[model samples]
Target: MPFALYLLGLAVFAQGTSEFMLSGLGPEIAAEMGVSLAAAGALTSAFAVGMVVGAPLMAALSLRWSRRGALLGFLGVFLAVHVVGAVTGSFTVLLVSRAVGALANAGFLAVALATATGMVASDAKGRATSALLGGVTLACIVGVPAGAVIGQLWGWRAAFWAVALLSLPAFAGILHSVPKGAAGGPGVRGELAALRSGRLRLTLLWGALVNGATFCTFTYLAPLATEVAGLGTGGVPVVLALFGVGSFVGVAMGGRIADVRPVPLLVGGGVALCAGWVLFALAAGEPAVALVLVLVQGALSFGVGSTLISQALYAAPGAPALAGGFATAAFNVGAALGPWAGGVAIGAGLGFRSPPVVSAGLVAIALVTAGMGRRVWRERVGSVSTGAQDK
Candidate 1:
């Protein structure tokens, strides 16, 4: 909608790069830090855990800060942590830095979503959320790969440095453009009280489940392509690129349809996401087919993701700030859990394809959750209208 919303998206790109670039930098960090790759992988896990808890923690802690101030505060922490990480030689310190950085990233994103939504008409929430999330998609397409290359050419620290440098412009843009919008919804007590809503909780669960579905399959995508689809290591990025392309397409289309038909987008996208995973697993041996499925799966993933964000804002229209933070924490919880679940399946000899099966179940849950929430929400609204008419 506004130029500031685009600025928020760019800020998202800066933070999101760190979220994914570490996936490709594990080996380098492991070697440099003299830790096992498993321990290095734990650094990524710490970031996810921080993100999973960050927003709620911030919402509870910083109930009085202006949206613009909160955004800048998070970015400042993120930038400083990245700089510290870039210069650090201690593995443990790096781990701590990653966690703090993720916390800041989560806070920034939650506020950004709330602020963006507040800027637009109620009907345009989807487009606003999508616009902000487009940063993550662009990072998937560009930043993560570029960071991988930077890591290989220079070092993992160099990638962190690059991210830190990028944060400068994002911080300036946010500071210059983002208004000090009044916080939406309730304060700390209000957020806690609002959590009691079954409908709100259901929406949060749906957010988590949908993300879990995507990550469950996505965690094993590289192995699936190499072992089952018969692709070389180099081809892995190509598959990821295809997924990114689909994400871009999905988010763009979802932005257009979300305000007009949020339920259908969530329902149909969730269903399509499940089917895509099933077909992907079945076509694991067919490289072309698997590649095509990657694109479709990516599209469905973001289409559903955008809908969840839109629904979160609409469902808790009174408390955009708190609802936004809570929704983010919910999604990241799923993001953290999905990979763990997939790893469990693979560990049990279910193979790479098993991940998609696991993901399919998650999507099914999300679909059911959405259906239940929609029904309950509609009934609640109808009751309110009936009460008003009687009065």
Candidate 2:
């Protein structure tokens, strides 16, 4: 792997920490803001929404500059947004800070992907992507829980400061380490042309559904650990850490098969996820079973994430740069939807475990959607073959 890739991973780790740290801070934020827990939960939704909007918008905007410069600009915006967040005592300001910070975070992530692939040799692209993704998974495994502990001991505002501190070096690294010639492409108009493809749209939908299925349950893991699984407060962090480990494992495992067997892998991932979540709901009363299910669920869900993304890109009929933007936005839109809907389920007295069941249902729906797309693909293939024979 290139040295620059590692620097990019470090940047990813910092940004991911900021993005997911909110998960552990949910209840604390609710109490501090004097709002319903559901309201504070919306903080996650707000960030997700920002990513949904920001990824494409920022990617489009970055086309005017070198990819390295674009990434640096976004990182600066990311750091500056956190400064406002760190200083704010108001709930409204906090929410706004999260959303704005996420916009910068989204743009940074979009360009960072471009830069990572550009930084490395062709054969090293896979390793580079894995490292960038690993940083994110490692952040989840380590950073979010640590941020939770920070919130538990000092205050949530302090967590923002920590993210800012982490981001500074990443900014400096991009400035110094990322060489010139990291140029942009044909821009958003080319990407928008992908809208003409029905298949690509479905693929993007698949991306959203996969992320929705994951976030629906994962978002409320803190409450589920305490309320449903009957873990003590201390155990909440332990379970979360384990979940992150599972995610890391999944990311590693997913990369292996994502290219060779994308459809089957996608189907298998969906089935495994649905089964895991259903089993989790059924076995919620058993602490040991619940814990195992939690970890395995993470693996099954994310293990094919890269493949699904690659598939989306392969299917896309637009600019390659926008391919990532499309896939990312799809997931974040689902990310936004998952928590908002989970909050609704909780508000309806469905309880924390209900979200997994909801996730299962969403996965099932995604599977059906996949089946439909597959059938269409086969028919298209058949039509082309028959036309060739006639010719």
Candidate 3:
């Protein structure tokens, strides 16, 4: 793997920290800005919405630009926006800054995905992608917690400043490592044409469903740990950290083998994830069991989830940039829908355990989708081979 790939991952780590640290600083932000908690939470929603919308749009717009230019521009925007967010006193300003920062983050991620895979052999796309995405898992383990601690000690604004500061190293590294005049994409039109493929569409759906199931349980893990598993508030962080560690392990292991055995990783990981969720639901009352299951769930969720992007890239050979954007959009869609589904289940009085059940259903649907996608892929390959033989 190229050292540039790890630098890109470092950039992702900075962006991801900003993305997730908001959760812990919500109360401080609300109080400081004199807004309701719900309003503060909307800041996160704004970021998510930006990420979903910005990925493909930015990828298309930047298709003609050099890859190095696009990445540096996005990182600069991200760094500037965080600085604005840090200094802004108005909640509206902060909200807008968060959204804009997310736009930059999404664009950077899309380009980085393309750039990373381009640097590797065709067979090692999965490993390259996992190397890039490992940043997010690292953020979950280190950055978010550190941000929370910073916010607790200083203020929410300090966390924003910290993100800005973190971004500086990434910006410098990307500037030094990524070559000048690196091509962005084939063209916007070619990218759009690639999106019409049925196999690509199914691959995106698979990504969304798998990510949705993962986030569904993750979003509600805190409540389940406390109300159901009888853990204190202090234990919640421990549980989350454990999950983060497991996810890191999963991504690392998956990266090593995913390119070689994509099907087994997805199918086996999906089945194990479903079973893990079911067991988590059943064992929610047992604190020890629940904690152990969270770790297992994280491993299964990420191990499978990490492959979807590589699959998307493979399915859309003509649109590497847009494929990265599509993968980003799919994961965000899942991230949004998963929590919403879990929320609905909880609101319906299904209890905290209901989220895991909902997750199980989502995983099952994802597995079925994966199966259908596999058939589609095989058919496409067969038809192409037949045409070649006739020629």
Instruction: Choose the strongest candidate by TM-score.
Output: 3
Across residues 1-391, which tens digit of lDDT does each residue of candidate 3 receive?
A: 9998999999999999999999999999999899999999999999999999999888887797999999999999999999999898899999999899989999999999999988887677789989999999999999999999999999988998898898888888888888897888789987888667777788788889889998998998889878999997888999899899999888888888777777778788989999889899999999889888988888888888888788778777678899999899999999999999999999999999999999999999988776766667544423312221121
Candidate with top lDDT is: 3
Put down candidate 1 lDDT per residue, 36-94, tens digits, no spaces: 99999998889988888888777555567888888888889999999999999999899
Ten contiguous residues minimizing lDDT sum, candidate 3: 382-391
Q: Write the number of the candidate with greater lDDT, choosing between 1 and 2.
A: 1
Decreasing TM-score order of the candidates? 3, 1, 2
Candidates arranged by lDDT, highest first: 3, 1, 2
For each candidate, give its TM-score against the true structure. Answer: 0.94, 0.86, 0.96
Q: List, residue by residue over 1-391, the lDDT tens digit for candidate 2.
A: 6787788888889888888888778888788779999999888878878989988788778878888888888888889888888787788988888888888888777777666655654323334456677778889888887888898899888898998999888888888888877767666676566545566677788778878888888888888888888987887777777788888888777766554455567777888888888998888768898889888987877775655665544454244456667667888888878877788899999888899888888888888888877754322222212221121
Candidate 2 — what's its lDDT? Answer: 0.76
Model 2, runs deviating above 4 Å: 23-43, 88-94, 118-128, 346-352, 375-391
lDDT of 2 at 30: 85
lDDT of 1: 0.83
Worst 10 residues of 2 by lDDT: 382-391
- Residue 311 lDDT in candidate 3: 74
Off by over 4 Å in 1: 180-186, 372-374, 379-391
Which prediction has more favorable TM-score, 1 or 2?
1
Per-residue error (Å), model 3, residue 47: 0.4
